[model samples]
Target: MLQDTTSSAPLRSLLFHLSDVELLTRSARQIVEEEAPPCYTLLIFTNGTGRLYIDNQPFLFSPDHCYLLSPGTSLQIENGTDTVVCFYRITFTVIQARDQQQVLYTEDIFPNRYELRVYPLSRLIRLTEQLYAGRLGKGDMEWFKQHLHFQELIGFLLEHNLHSDPSLSLTQSVENTIHYLNHNFMDSITVKQLVQLANVPHWQYTSIFQELTGKKPLDYLTELRINRSKEWLAISNAPLRDIAHRVGFADEYYFNRRFRQTTGVTPRQYAISMRQRVLVKDWTGHEVHIPLQPLRIIYYGETIGDLVTLGIHPIGGNIPNPENRLYKDPTTIIHDVGFPFNTERASALEPDLIIFANSDERQYEQISKIAPTITYNSWATLEERMHILGDWFGKKREAEQWLVHHHNKTKTMWQQLQSSINAGETASVFTYDHGERLFVMGVTGFSTALYHPLGFRPVSKIQDILDAGQGYKEIQESSLPQYAGDRIFMLLPENKISRRAAEDMMNSTLWQSLPAVQSGHVYMAEEAKWNFGDAFTRDKLLEMLPELLQGF
Candidate 1:
């Protein structure tokens, strides 16, 4: 009866009562009707960097941001990239009557469910703490006491939601601090200094910083200094003490210790790996004399898995999103050269060679100055990339071996898949990135792996994109039926909004009505794990596809 439709009308009275109040500390904690009868519940995250899911939709939780959930909404907290999540769950009820006649006006007191960000969140936290503390007492009087505070908290939310913009935002302040840290890594910095820069409480700043950068303030600072020091150690003949001082370290021993800890190698050992020369014309037509047997290499491209599979490990590389890893090994020692290539960090490694994937002349010029940079085409076929990598890195024999192995295994894999999959069945992959944007993969990404002559045919629209040589294209949701094939694959990204949108569509009647969905042929893949078009990811997809296709 309480879950009926709501209509706005004259409200003369409101019956609001606090039904429950508790602090959730565990990551696996869920608020279902069985555990605690679901009502209008407010989640006040005091400290958390975990993913919050409401009825299967993912949400990235931030401290001091209060999310109001509707009645009977399934709340599940899952681990994010970092941090243990903790939040206050305050459940309540609010109903309005028409014209003081006791006729039910509407159950819509505020919005059904929404996230509210108001300045000075300390006030809300204080009230929540007071209410949670009061809940520990055993009495009807305690319930009565907490109800008054609940009313005040509701009033605060309703009033503050009206303000469209606040002069100061905690997220904005932390973002600015991140910029500050990037530019000033050479300067002495601490967590306290960053907290002051953000102008927020110490506890709040920590969670916000971690959520934004996926690293603690001090840890981030240390990485920056070490990265800079790595460059100095390679390019300059400065003493270890001098390099330490210049890179913001107080002592040489401390700098040496941190460098070894982060890079998985001592500074001296890393330097010794860069030497010799082998002249070659790269894909971009630049004649670069690279290292004869490059050991300390920086691979700036999507084909990192190619190196991983080749038994040649790069000491440093560019992983735009750390989630989209080259391999499953968490201990890979590839230092990130940053997206689009952070030339400063690239030069810092003093790499003997830089295998950059971008074809942009401007960016190539910038990165080439750092090392013997070789620009390569990531769009090339797996065999093409391997052949080029082999010649460039003096692994011609190794390259030939992998191609033979790849072709043989690939032929065998599709032969197995052909048994279960119907002939001429088309397969398509799409994803929602950052927001509601829907992008259909064409010749690149998982499509390259899936669209073998023996495997699956491409849908008409996607085939056109493949002909046009475009990696992906955004299409209207209405065109999904046309673009969708006999088999559907959805690559869900790490972005919170994108994941939620994809999840919502999956639950929608329209999505359920799709022919692929009806036949239970729809598959979902993590963007980080499967969305790469690189030969390495394509190879991994070979092993992954059979299991996913057959659901074995």
Candidate 2:
């Protein structure tokens, strides 16, 4: 009988040739008894009853049965049959088999190997014969033999063990949900709606949805709408209001608000501005053959001046009644000094005279080389800028009259709204991003242009924060003013993170506790319009403010 090896000792092996067939069985029994090497022993029982005991637990084996004993496990065998048990045994040290790195023995080799039967007596006998023949002969290469044996063994096991089990009903349910969302994405959809469509409880459906496709259902739907909207915005010339309605927004205002919130500019502005940068229209129609003299004029930024050159009308200037005054002769080719005035690009596009409004003297120095560049720092003050432009173009007198007319018209509109505003009513301007971060815009920021011009004052604390230069930072760094005010205007972010952050803030206890939140005075501005900072954006705010403020 083989004696037991010490538990603490490392395994050792001795190479011995199989000389006698009868002695092989006897040696196997000794090896089983000793459990000395603490390695695998392949045993095949061809006749008579046999039993293998592991860790003192008996596992009965028949003539057709085979047992693979794991290393480090103790085993004892007993033969109950009167006839000598005919068996074949192989004891090998598992010192890094060559086929170990092959896919044949990888973790996924058997899908459910633990529950399946493998290594029957007949199969084990064949494998042992192959192993014995390969080991005993010098003709067979060790690597090839190992590879063939391992491949055959894995193939046999996998063919019997690996089977797929997927529920058809579950797959169909997911398909239906995806189809419904794709067909009706523009319509307002909620989690509850998806759960209903999937015909599963909300909690169960959420898990299945994520497990199947790795995204929340609503998030996926929102992305679809946003993507589709982008395509329509870029290629289609439909009115924004029509596009908004077609995309399932109940009103153009809300659609504009959401589009801007998502894309940072209004749909019209994004289309027009981006198109202007790349679009070069062929000169068509009868060229009003005017003597094309080089006219010196400076404008802001390279692209801005370039765009203006493309659209400049020769018939209009600061001339009084210019809208009615038509010039039969085309004027000189207008020369641009370049935009933003101070850039290297502007320096390259040298001009005889520089025309810039609302920029500082620093911007004027670069163009001073070409000619005396006029600086108009107060251009941001709409009235002042209009006058400056009018004067520079030899239409100062005409521009003053136009300014007076529009100023009166705007003032009247402001007075009308003010007359209706309830006493002590307050307002605040704030912007939000997709990440849910709120930015408080001061009275001076472009956001407050509509309200501030109309004699509406921001709440004291809001103004103080704005005055302290605290509101212009990115949303994460800025804080929401404590004053609740009667009304709050918020600009939203275009990206998903900013949107989620803004939504999180809206649902937070801190936000709910604020007076605006409590009174439902919060209003979201159209993101597209908010981003443009153009005439259309200004017009939208003007139209929206009175109604929004009235509710507060």
The TM-scores, one per candidate, come to 0.53, 0.34
Q: Write the per-residue lDDT of candidate 2 for residues 1-552, one digit (tens) a residue.
A: 111121311112212222211113322123246453344445555443444665565444444344444445566766543323445555544332343341111121222111123445235444444444344223346446544664464345344334422232344355446655654677877889777655666787787777866888866665566555654665458887777766666777876777687778887886655332111111122112211121334444211211132232321112111111111111222222223233454444333334444344454455455544444442144454455445344456665665576557667767778765545667766656535456666533444454445555667766675566453434343245455467666655545576567666666777777787777667664342343332223433454455555632
Model 1 ranges off by over 4 Å? 1-274, 323-331
**Model 1: how far residue 65 lies from native, Å:** 33
Q: Compare the candidates by lDDT and give the number of the best one.
A: 1
| Tens digit of per-residue lDDT, candidate 1, span 1-552 | 001113322323766678788665543233322242346778887553445566665445555657777666666766432223456788877666655555322233433335565556646865675576456345677577667878878778766654333322566567656755654577878888877766678888899889987998899889878866765666557788998998899998998899999988888876665444668998879898876766567888777887777777776776545434354332234666667578888777678678888889998888778778888888777788888888877788988998898888888999987788988999899899859888999866788888888889998888899888888899887788989999999887667798778778777887888999999898766675578877677776777788677753
Model 1: pairs clashing at backbone N, Cα or C within 3 Å: 231-348
Most accurate candidate by TM-score: 1
Candidate 1 scores a C-alpha RMSD against the true structure in Å of 16.3
Report model 2's TM-score to 2 decimal places: 0.34
